[model samples]
Target: MCKAWDRNMYKLRFIISFQVQLIINFKLIAICSHQIFL
Candidate 1:
């Protein structure tokens, strides 16, 4: 049972980090496009 909980926690952390990375990527792209338009 402890092992299963640990696995779940790891998966959750991975997913959270992935989402954060995606958001940062999108922000960078937006900034680049805005600069290009200006």
Candidate 2:
């Protein structure tokens, strides 16, 4: 049971980190586009 809980926690953490990374990448792309426009 403990192992299952731990695995779930790891999955949740991984998802959050993945989302954060995606957000950062999106922001970077937006900034690059804005710079090009200016």
Candidate 2 residue lDDT tens string, 1-38: 99999999999999999999999999999999999999
For all candidates, what are the clash counts?
0, 0
Per-residue lDDT, model 2, residue 34, is 100
| lDDT of candidates 1 onward, in order | 1.00, 1.00
Residue 24 Cα positional deviation in candidate 2, in Å, after optimal superposition:
0.2
Candidate 2 segments exceeding 4 Å error: none
TM-score of 2: 0.95
- What does the lDDT come to for candidate 1? 1.00
